[model samples]
Target: MDTVYSVVGLGKLGASMAAAIASRGFRVIGVDINRRAVEAVNAGQAPVQETGLEELIAANQKRLRATLDHHEAVLNSDVTFVVVPTPSDERGAFSLQYAAWAFRKIGYALKEKKGYHLVVLTSTVLPGSTRYGLLPILEKESGKRCGVDFGLCYSPEFIALGSVIRDFLNPDFTLIGEYDEKSGSLLESTYARILENNAPCYRMSFENAELAKIAVNTFVTMKITFANMLADLCERIPGGNIDAVTQALGADQRIGPKYLKGSLGYGGPCFPRDNIALSFFARAVDTAAELAETTDRINRALPAKIVEQLKPFFHKGATVAVLGLAYKPFSHVVEESQGIYLAKTLADIGFRVVGYDPLAAEPARIELRDQAVVLDSLEECLNQAEVVIIATPDPVFRRLTLADLQDRNVETVVDCWRILEKELKGHSIRYITIGQNINDEESQARLIKLWGNTDANSDT
Candidate 1:
């Protein structure tokens, strides 16, 4: 028999997962507290804005539906995936408040259901959260034995906001934290059917899977931080180029580079918080995650450091244009965005700031209210500034021509991602690529002083 899937919490990740599963010919029912989200799904629309989500949901409307009732979703589907938000608390640990409520509802629903069902947690939480914190709620509320009566698994998806659907369908590997062999095998089989790729499944105990999820994200953040440090070093070296260095580094079999781009600091909902959370968890366990802690601190300090570097360029009330308010490119999610941080920091330092994003203008406006003027178009932002800073590697920013940046008032172009290096290098404006040496003469003198002159042969 085909597995009927139910997804709780119709947020970006949950809704996309539901739509993706239904796209694979599975009957998927989604449950959410938001009436609008439920209505949107039923009306053949995406509840949240994600790349290819609305189209996917609309195409798979026949197989996908949503409801507000947890009982209905739990009773109907063979497997239920809890994808509710596990927001971080004061201590940097993910709060289980939302997940606990969702679990309680599912527990009550399970009491009335006849056959065996599997409850899968797809939320990011600290280790022992699933087996110790959440499982007891299910057992107590439902009044049923876990392994004998039903099953549970902690299987968080490795996905980003913009490409959730594609990532879901084509994950590098599936991490399943199962209660037992029966539960793990059931989910593994379901994933084999649903996933587009022949992805390997790593099944283990619940706690191990929970740790692995955060560990993956935290480790990636460390790699990103390491690259950002290299960018800092490159700026001081003669003939330094981050791309050249990273390209060579990536060729090494040991360091197959994905996040080795020595540009701006990494920011988004996941990368920043995951590192801090790992540090918090380490301290809680009477150990230390000093590397994770340092990574987070360095990333957080990046905006201020960049502002200090550009301080000399700022005059009394000089207008600075910040392009790309979203963390990376595409989509309109600005949570923990480094672009927003730059704008805010510049504004606080008495520079007149104007910010622009292709999609995240409104959210950036809300975030930068009165701190910086969030403009609708990149052209408008460029027109109002003496200095332009490309904070994200958005394709729109890359498409900017020499004509667009040729304003007499504009004196500098700080290309954090080096997108406009070739086009703007010899332009009238003082072009500064973050990871490249700006003072060539000074750098050369320092190198010659350190290593002695290569031009003159030394007597042996």
Candidate 2:
């Protein structure tokens, strides 16, 4: 493609996109305020760590380059993609402090360019942010009209951190919130050229696109919460299995199998916060997002509830090993992780807790501090524990053999994902999960009394 692409921000997502776009035979320029990140990219190395990012950047160095000068990137490239941080505020709204600063830099660059430049905002924001929040800054700074001299589009990337390159290249659909027809069409064609797969694009106004981006994450959180709710119900029902219930529920076309599995609550950088931000937005519009509010409450309460469930399994002084400290497998991010909350609560309640993850050990250490020891070795964590919690559905933890726990003093195992059910069935260790009934006398007696023949007794 003749059009040069420039990505502002050299973070994981931005660096990955610059590399991916260059791989598709486009000359790409990356702009970042960090001098170290800029130097890293220009030296044929990845500015940040991600799956296959270093290799991809190294391979595409001839086509891709990075700079600290926004003017250099914008003046040289036809399209500039802004992917700066939109961190959550105290009230759950996305703070556009970083985005506004980045846009002002691009605005100065746009002032010098004579040709039409399409500036795309890929940062997550609420409705009216692009039109009402950012567009005015660009217009005032550049001293030019948007539709006439420059173009704008609010097109956020729907991608997970670990698999950003692949997800960006092959999305279910692309959403384009356009300032005008000219800008949106340019972006649509650019995506068509960049994407290996011919993904369909959904075009709309700026506000619609902004709302849609947050809505997708919020809706998925609700689905995850619903599945988690069923898991709690399964624990009380006779012969109840959450897996079976969700499987049947998923068979209906109205509900798909994705995110329907009953496990720990959803967490990461995005899902939990999106629900809160949407609720905040709803309140700003003078309405109540009761469902979202409830979902957030239930997810936040899971760690405490889980600790209560394990009260009978171990005493105060016993050591507990929490496997998989990251929010998900193949990722190092521990932001809003359920495993973090679980480990902290267990340690707070007087249990000595040690946690392990394949990628997130160092960051987990910083997050947990003295509350729980973050171990670098899974073997060490497994070896020094009386109880083990399979906190995430990591493949490494799933492949754990009975021999791995042989020399350990572990008396009980709580498998959140139920991956060890078959392996631990007849073992000497006590195996318990969230979804299935354990044939406990207390639960059975409680059910019997609740469903007793009250009418027959009253007649007598």
lDDT of 1 at 348: 90
Which stretches of model 1 miss by more than 4 angstroms?
448-460
Across 1-460, the per-residue lDDT of candidate 1 in tens digits comes to 7789999999999999999999999999999999999999999998888999999999999999999999999999999999999998999999999999999999999998899999999999999999999999999999998998899999999998899999999999999999999999999998999999999999999989999999999888888888889988888898888888899998998887899999889888889999888998899889999999999999999999989987876677889999999988987989999999999999897889999999998899888889999988877888898999999999999998777778547888999999988888987888988889888788888887887856566586
Q: How high is the CA lDDT of each candidate model?
A: 0.92, 0.92
Model 1, TM vs. native: 0.97
Q: How far is candidate 2 from the true structure (C-alpha RMSD, Å)?
A: 1.7
